[model samples]
Target: MSSHLQAHAAELAHGFSLCELAEGLGHLDMDGADDVLIMGICDDSRHAKPGYAMLCLPRAEGRASEFAESARELGATAIISVGIPVDTQLPSLHLDSMGQAGTLLRRMFKTEQAGAHLYGITGTDGKTSVTWMLREALSRYQQQPVWSTGTLGLMRSSDDIRDIGNTTPSLLTMHAMLAEACREHVHSVVSEISSHGIAQSRIAGLDFRTAIWTSMGHDHLQDHGGYGPYLAIKAGFVCDCGSHGGNVIANADHADIRERAPASSRWYGHGLSRDDVDMGWEQELPGMLRLRSRGEEVVIEDIPLGDFHAENVACVALILMVSQDIGLQELPELLSGITAPPGRMQDVLAGYGQVFIDYAHTPEALERCLRAARKLARNRLIVAFGCGGERDREKRPQMGEIAVEFADAVWITSDNPRGELPAVIASEIEFGMQKPYRAEVHLQLDRDKAIGEAVAALAEGDILVIAGKGHEAYMEVCGRRMPWSDAEAAEKYLRRKNSGTGLVSEGEDICA
Candidate 1:
């Protein structure tokens, strides 16, 4: 276990009596189970331990009740079921809905009034970028620890990251992390709130200081059933945060977001003339960005990335300005040292040309990344990416269309074919490519081979983008996660080609 988890476990060592838990959760009638002591709470049976209550909830694949016996054998003291009863001799609490789980867990973990200033960023893309940016800027400005949680995992710093399974962790895990942060004297936390997180009520009962909407796109339709519902879930988060007295920061460039966002939201975007949007930015030179808000303007120099980052930077600036009372003059210095999060346009320098690895799985994100790469490419732009299995299949062809439209070359490869065939996913993506493909496009099922081939083919002044699994260190195949990394594959091929030894040097893992 990591020191972070260890500290969190230790914090819960005092435990809570069954009566206290029931009263905190508003369940006044505990009857005979009032005296049972609960040390921890767990949703997964595999992690259940002595004096812990096992939560048997509904899941996509199966009911958690199927593993109640395992949890019992592992020393679970009680069972908490949501709409489903578990056949166990252990004392249990039955609830009608999952919405109460977060409240109950927060009470169990003693984090109902966590001191950290919680900032939430939600959208299909830019969530990870904005979350990390907030962490960096806030940590620099406050001169204290600032934590963040999202696709990159629960991170206290770049060097301290612990994967809690999903982008938005389970309710039990979320409260536990917050409790840990409080114990560490961390004052701020930025989190990426996914659509699935909102729909599943993972963030329930938590108060956010600010809710940021980055950009809505065509992604996660499979999990939400359709685009409208997916969008509703995103909008619901922003509106809920706003209604609860939290500041709402939205991207004015996205019409859907602009329309659905609360009227009181603070808007930020590029080239917007609306009076409501006080935050806007533009690239004045190759490496300089000028931000304008109200009547003040600040010019940031030596920006290492593309124009797409202008909006992300502007969003970060707006948050600091409104929430932290940070002046515009202070932004240039605080943001000058900020870097993109791992797997977010991370560049690996080669002897010839440039290679970037990004987690651009959505069509909108992929197009933006390719467009940025095009501006830096003097020769040709090549991209290697693949769609994940069992996701929004409609976007596969859309991404294929976008890749060919902006990139001079494309390589379609496997990106975690969990249960579906990689060939089928590639074929679906290829179906959307224009007939008589304008660019040199190849369909390779082997991801490492595809990345190696792309790197080996790079020419001077050329740029290659390896997309889909940015900072991820593992590939999920046949229900097993194997160690893998796109950046590592690209660098290995580049090293071998440059050395002429046909041997690659083992490089240190880059912090994500």
Candidate 2:
């Protein structure tokens, strides 16, 4: 086991009694139940072990009571359910609601004393980007280890990440990660709070020192029921931070976010009125960002990306200013070397033309990525993208419309069409294209083939963007996840073309 795991194991060596666990949850009366010893806690029956307390929460698959027997078979000493009485031989604790689960887990794990400044970032887009940017900026500014957890994974640094299966992991897993980070002497933690995580109460008990709202857009509507609920969930995170005496940083460019943001929120954005926001940035030149804050401006040169990223950078700057008391003049050196997280505008090949991979699944994200790609393209800009299965279907045609509007050529391919027909998803996206179809568009269900063809079509000075599934290494089809990557597929085609092994017409000279 790792040192942190060893430390956590040592910490949990003295198990908590049933009475102590109940008391920690503010339940004075344990009724006549025996004071069973609990050494570990888990939500999944598969992870249940001897002396462990299995939390039987309702999952999409089944009810809480259904897993009680399995957990009991795995040697779980007790059962904790949310108002669901389990007919099991093991001792059980019935909670009033699901919200109490996080509290109970945090108490058992002692995560509140994790000794790390916690930062929560929530939004439809740019959450991952801002999380990583803040992680890098803070690490450099503080000269200490700063960790971040998000869609990428549990990252100790940019190059060190351990996949924990979700953007915002389950309450038990989240607390465990935080406790381990504390053991590692990590200075702070930047975490991405997803809408599903919020609705599910995954982050129930942890306290944040600062909460960041990157931007809000139409995403996960099906899960949230509508835009209003989605916006409310994102807004509620920052509002809760403010209520807890934590700092709030929001994007002022978003009107709904601005209106809903807390009164004391430190705002950051682009093109907003000078007096409106606490921090702002503008593209002074190509690959250059000029940040304005507190009547002082600092220009960060060699940005290495598009203008859309300026807002994320500005958000990071504002976070340092608010939380770390870092000065504006220090930002140029602190953040000058910061790079975008993998799969969020990752450049793969740049020889004859350039190929970029991005995780742009939403309409707004797709538009921003395409616009950024368009600016970087000296010649034609081709884009290949698709929507995920069982997600917000409303953005399908919207993304198609955006693709046609910005790209010279569009390839709509499959993106994790889990339990949904890839052809149907592609048709819905195609339905949104302009009537005249100003750009050349094609629907290819095979993602690898689409990427290969798109890469082959790129000429000198041209740019090709492979969107959706940026950093994801697997493609979920039906119920199984198959190993896949857009960056690898693009590079494979690029290598074949460069090595004179790719298919070419008669007498056509290969560019070398």
Candidate models: Cα lDDT each: 0.82, 0.82
Worst 10 residues of 1 by lDDT: 503-512
What are the clash counts of all predictions, listed in order?
0, 0
Best-performing candidate as measured by TM-score: 2
In candidate 1 the C-alpha lDDT for residue 29 amounts to 31
Which lDDT tens digits does candidate 2 get at residues 280-332? 88986656788888788898776558666777888988999999988889899
Give stretches of model 2 more than 4 Å off. 1-13, 24-34, 58-62, 350-353, 504-512
Q: Estimated TM-score per prediction?
A: 0.91, 0.92
What TM-score should be assigned to candidate 2?
0.92
